[model samples]
Target: MIAINNLTFEIGARALYDEANWHIKPGEKIGLIGANGTGKTTLLKLIVGDYKPTSGTISKSKELTIGYLNQDLLSYASDKSILHVAMEAFDRQNQLHTEIETLLKKLETDYSEDLLNKLSDKQQEFEALDGYNIEYKAHEILAGLGFSDVDQERKLSTFSGGWRMRVMLAKILLQAPDILLLDEPTNHLDLPSIQWLEDYLKNFEGAIVIVSHDRWFLDKVINRTVESRKGKLTVYAGNYTFYLEEKSLREEIQRGEFKNQQAKIKQEERLIERFRAKASKAKMAQSRIKMLDKMERVDDVDDDNPSVNFNFKFTKQSGRHVINIENLGKSYPNLEILDHANAVIEKGDKIALIGANGRGKSTLLRIIAGADKTFTGKSDTGYNVTQTFFAQHQLESLHLESEILQELQTFAPKHTDTELRSILGSFLFTGDDVFKKIKVLSGGEKSRVALAKALTADANFLILDEPTNHLDMQSVNILIQALQQYEGTFIAVSHDRYFLDNIANKIWYIEDHKIKEYPGTYAEYEEWQNKRKLQPKTAAPAPQPKKEEKKPVVQQPTEDKSKQLKKLNQDLGRMEQQISDLEKEVKQLETKLADDSIYSNANKLKETNSAYQQKQSALKQVQQQWETLAEQIMELEA
Candidate 1:
């Protein structure tokens, strides 16, 4: 529905697009991809009329409605509830509802024929717009995007920026625009949410242009790939994997053509040099020169080498057992997020922590990293185990006033300026970019800085939470390569399938307050899950020992043990619910504190902070109780 005709967009002296032409056909799902600073986002803006091309045209059908989900969350109504914001997407339907209400009120007063006719028209319009079920649709979209009913009712300001972006995305999807432009839409989503989005977009009835570093997401969601580089667009007929293969083949062919052309040019120059002074051969030399001048030079293909390499450095190695948790338990007041959990992590074990959002994956990581102190468990680090915890908020905690290079230097004060610069350069910070203040850097840039710091920390154990969220594909690949070769132990919470496939050798799946260990990659875990679903559920019990050989046992005691186990489980479940509820309240209050307007009102700010602190304290007490109960349960199990 959108046509880019000979588009040429320039920024000062830099040309982002030069006579670039591309088209978005109806129902075509295209992944817009390129290196960082290659104008992928700019291209989307150009299509959406946020930026005008220096020359040429981007024509769209007059009837087409476009929805653009930008990487940045700007001008959103923070005070409004998420559901309200989402419902605003159906403005026309809402207007019809308002009109119908007005007409009904007029009828109640003493309606004329004109008012009746107007009411009838509005009712028809409302039905056509599906106004009767707008609330249901909005709630469905919100729930699909991972928002609870209570969360939907909470003000948008309570959520983090990532979740706010999701809110915006829900609004766009609810609007059902003809063309959807998404830039890094999966950046903040967890695995479950990403899967939900994949399903939603797969069945989306519109043209989609998505710019994402998520290879699996691109492969699963898009039918085509569009690579924008050097102010030109190259279209691939298939998905991301197909694009890689086809692009490789095309490059090989181009190399051959380039080689042959170079050889011919060299021969022509040799002939010109040999016959330059002879009149008999002068015409021939002139002809060769003209041919050489007219020949088009082929541009070199981009190299895949990243500017920075993340070589995880460690000052010392940890003992065989990197981390050991026995009877680990954490809970909200009524919610038992984890109960009687036990796990032993060994040295060099690369574990991928996977689960639904808010299901304690990050919580477990924090506890392991020693960041969370309010947990009932025996958590012990092996000898000489130094850890670096790259939490989700790590980037936000960066000193925005510091320069990019300065940030890394602070992490590695012993390293000289030259060494620090070299490390920074490997991550793509070069020349002036190294000196650029962190405040001015983009989200991806800040992520790179955080990654660089993590690499320089010299820790033998790394606890990384969503490290690849803001990285580009190339950087992510470099990170995967580095992690694959890392000598240290790693426990990471990530949703990127490609990253997990390359890095994680074990999966620690958190489900229903327990950890399920799978000794394979994420793909294998998914396969195993799918296979389990297909297989019939008839698990055979282990055979009992022969009565003659079996030792005498206390039947009453055995029965009592079973009853105790069941009771413990039931109590754990209740405590977990209580904890979850309390935590949710604390989160909502924190979100309220996050609002700028709330801070401006001193009384409200104090009240909210006080409530948050009180909830935190109450949750801690309940967690302690849950932990004590967990210890008892663990003893019983033992």
Candidate 2:
């Protein structure tokens, strides 16, 4: 639907895109990815025509309509209600409807052929556009984006910036443009809202290009990846996971080629240097020198795989029981954040706490971690259970004058200077980077520092609030791996599904002022969510009539009874087959887990265990049902 030809964009002395050529196909869901400051957002703006390229042309079909959700700045009147702003997307249809109404009224008064014809045309136009259901569609989109019923009627001024962004997202979804451009679309979305969006975009009938830092979200939503790196664009044919593997493979090939070319050039230079010392071979040496000069120089391959090392070691181990909470309750004057919250943490449960935004997911985390104690219930820690909390407001604790190395030492005073430096290096802080003041670090860098400090606390239980907020995909994956291997308990509030799916053993869903635990993987939770959405909230179906009771009578087997028994046996056999299949799958997963190679990586092992658990659960349920049918068949046989 859109094409870029030799596009070049430069800012100050840096080139964002140079001679970039790319195409956006119809109905393509493209994920735009790159390191921070690599100009992923800038490329989106160029496609949307917000910024003109330095050279070359960006062309789009004349009839194509584009909707862009930019993160830079959004404009909305504070006094306008949320609903009012969202409804503006359907202004054209609304105006058409209004015109039709006016023309109908005129037709009724004039009773002329011209007026009647005009009214007929206007009515046809309105119906053709499906104008009647515009209001309902708008409301549905708003609610799907996490706006409550009351929020729709509230003035925009009362909402925060995040809500305003949601309002903008609602409008864009309602508009249903030909091309959708979104930048950091999931930044403000909670788990439920993000899930809703994934479903919506999967069915969206248009080309979509989104810039998001959440690798898990992108992997779920986009089928293709478009990366802007250095000053060029590279396209990958699969999702974020596939992109990671493909990028690594491509870089390895490039590195090999570069190395071979460098070796050949050096060998030629050495040969020419030796030959030049002999008078008789001077001509040959000169010819070789010319050949060397004519050789096309191979550019040094960039560091294709920049590895980040984060080694977190605690100073001391904690007691067996890490954190304990009992009937925790917190309430404002009129609003209750949490009521009678209760949970317990042993030594090594990796828990993911999830809920809609503002439902107190963070509040519960803070309460258990002892950062906030203004609660009605009791919170107790086991003996010597040290705790470290990585809060959403972690940036506030950073000191401006402290270097990265000094900051680590400050958090972990018992560690030697060499130990502190080693820890800093593991988190990608090295040489001059270690000397940079805390205040000078970017938001992402500061988040890494905060995480490093938390890890160095030697706490048996860690409470992390959005720990992956500013980290890249690799960094997030590394953290997930580390947490999975750590011999401690973890309670974290995060919206990253892949991270949660890979690491968490249990999910604590906070909803309707209550917390509920579910024993399953994220895929199972998604399946449950889909089933819930499919189910209607109607009154329960009327109970079936009870079967008539038969009088006890001794009799010989009849032909009809024999046929019934045969059919029941057949059904029981089918159920047994299903149970057997499930058991086989579970056994296969178990075998994979037992393999030494697969178990070497903590993350892979965790994923395998989760799959094994799910398969086992399925097998148990299937076996139970199968046994029940078998019993029924046996009774009939008797």
Name model 2 segments beyond 4 Å from true.
73-75, 97-120, 297-310, 332-339, 416-418, 481-485, 511-514, 519-638
Task: For residue 279, give model 1's deviation from the true position in Å.
Answer: 8.5
lDDT of 2 by residue, 31-62 (tens): 99887788888888788778999998999999
lDDT of 1: 0.85
**Candidate 1 on 358-451: residue-level lDDT in tens?**
8988889889988889989778776568988986588888999999888878778977788778777777788988999999988888888898
Q: List the lowest-lDDT window of 10 residues for candidate 1.
A: 534-543
Model 2 / residue 494 / CA error / Å: 0.7
Which ranges of candidate 1 are over 4 A from the true structure? 111-117, 276-287, 305-315, 333-335, 396-410, 413-422, 430-440, 532-638
Clashes of each: 17, 2
Which candidate wins on lDDT? 1
Clash count, candidate 1: 17
